[model samples]
Target: MNCEEATKLLDGYLDGELDPITSQQIEQHLRDCRT
Candidate 1:
């Protein structure tokens, strides 16, 4: 996913509302992105 989607999912992640796949996507994005 893009930064926009990962960024948007941040809240849901913190709130424990997102599914495993979505949360993993965001985690992967953060791991690979540095800007």
Candidate 2:
């Protein structure tokens, strides 16, 4: 995922509102990205 998408989803991630697959993707994205 790109920065924009990840940023948009960050609130959901923090709130635990996203699905497992999407959360995993976001986690992986965070791991790959310096942000």
> Top model by TM-score, which number?
2
- Candidate 1 residues 1-35, lDDT tens each? 88888888899998989999998998899999988
Residue 19 in candidate 2 has what lDDT?
A: 99
The Cα error of candidate 1 at residue 1, in Å, is 0.9
- lDDT over C-alpha atoms for residue 15 of model 1: 95
* Clash count of each predicted structure: 0, 0
Candidates in order have lDDT scores of: 0.90, 0.95
Question: Poorest 10 consecutive residues of model 2 by lDDT?
Answer: 26-35
List ranges where model 1 is wrong by over 4 Å.
Answer: none
Judged by lDDT against the true structure, how good is candidate 2?
0.95
